[model samples]
Every structure is written in C-alpha cells, then in structure tokens.
Target: MDNRVLYERLGGVFAIAAVVDDFIDRVLSSPALNANPLVREAHHRVAPAGFKYLVTEQLCHAAGGPQRYTGRDMKTSHAELRISEDEWQAFLDLLKQSLDKFRVPLREQGEIFAIVQSTQTDIVV
Candidate 1:
C-alpha cells in the first residue's frame, strides 16, 4: 500500500504552495465570491502573498506535513464574513478548478476535499 501522507503525495510545500497560489488568485478575482462585500473587502485588505502563505501552511498541516498552521481558527477567522451555502459551493468549485488545473490525482483530491469539508460548518453561515 502507498503509505505516503497527503502532503508527500501532493509534492510537499512547493507543490502545495503553487496550488494555493493559483487557488487564491482565482478566489480573489472571482466576482461571485466578491459579491459578498465582506469577502471582497477581506480579499483586498490582505496581501495576496501572505494570504497564500497562510493557506499553504494550513493545507500542509491538514495534509500531515511538517508545517504547522499558525493561522486563526476557521470559525473565528470567518465569523464576520457571513458566507452562504451558495458562496461556499462557489468556493469549492474554484478549488476543484485549481486541483484539476494541476492534474492532482483523484485520491489526493478526495483527501484534500475531505479536509476542506471539515471546515464548511465554520465557514458557512
């Protein structure tokens, strides 16, 4: 059996960061996501590079990498955004686009989606 952690399967920090970069850029530029004024403001308020760094760290940690995420909890971080179910789905769709663009294997994508799904309750209002 392939026993590699999701982080290893995903090619470690460099590969994870590359995907985060693309995903964040897509999120930042998406009018659908930005339709929520709070999301739009938050996207513009934070430096793109720093946001990407945190996401990479978070994903790496969640994927069982050596990196530890130093960011705030999902609930606290997203508390004020007031995201809806549709917006959340839109976000997931963008993530899927990123994974597909990178040609991430199906198993790895499923693992990543599971990680993302765990945060949905905290993120969606």
Candidate 2:
C-alpha cells in the first residue's frame, strides 16, 4: 500500500477545511441552488459554519485524513432537497471553481471529484 494519502497531498486538514469553507459559502449563496424552495428553506435553516465543519470533516475523512465525518449520510441529508440534474451540475461547477481557486493539482482534483461523484446517487433525488 502506498503510504501516501490524499489528505497529505491536499495539504492536510487545514487546507481541506479552507476549501470546504469556500465551497460551502458558494453553495449557500448560489442563486441557482437557492431557487428551489426546499433548498432555500434548508439553506436558511442550517448554520453555514456548522455545515462547513461537517463538509470539511467528510472531505478530510474521504481523503484519508484523521478526521471522522459526524454529519448525516448523504441520502438522509439531501433526499428531501429533491435536487434536479441542473442543480447538481451547478453544484459540481461550484466545487470545481473552488478547487481551481485553491490551485488544486489535476490529479488531486480528479480524486476529490471521484469521491464527490460517488455520493451523487445518494444526493440527487
């Protein structure tokens, strides 16, 4: 097993957390995402900082970092949102924008995207 992990490649927890913070901010404020009544309501209900923390934990865990995700499962959290394909694509675009802003390497971006893609079925109702 290659001892190297994606977490280290991503500059560890702090870096991942930074990216998550930016991504969450973008998602929470995106007009496209908020256009959906359910999404808008949930976005307004959840605390952005707490949402960022959970996303950071999930990302760190997915990248093989020490942190464990304490948030709800993707299906449970997103099922009620009823996200459309367009909204899902918009979310992905925002993630890519965030990754680009951080100058994430292509390989790391691909790995991160794969991890995110794995949850698509659960998230996109």
Instruction: Please give, for residues 33-95, the per-residue lDDT of candidate 2 as tens digits.
Output: 999999999999999999999999999999999999998999999989999999999999999
Q: So what's the TM-score on candidate 1? A: 0.98
Candidate 1 C-alpha RMSD relative to the actual structure: 0.6
Q: Which candidate tops lDDT? A: 1
Q: Deviation in angstroms for 88 in model 1?
A: 0.3
lDDT of 1 at 23: 99
lDDT of 1 by residue, 10-124 (tens): 9999999999999999999999999999999998999999999999999999999999999999999999999999999999999999999999999999999999999999999
TM-score, cand. 2 = 0.96
Give all TM-scores, in the order shown: 0.98, 0.96
Question: Which residue runs of candidate 2 sit more than 4 Å off their true CA positions?
Answer: 1-3
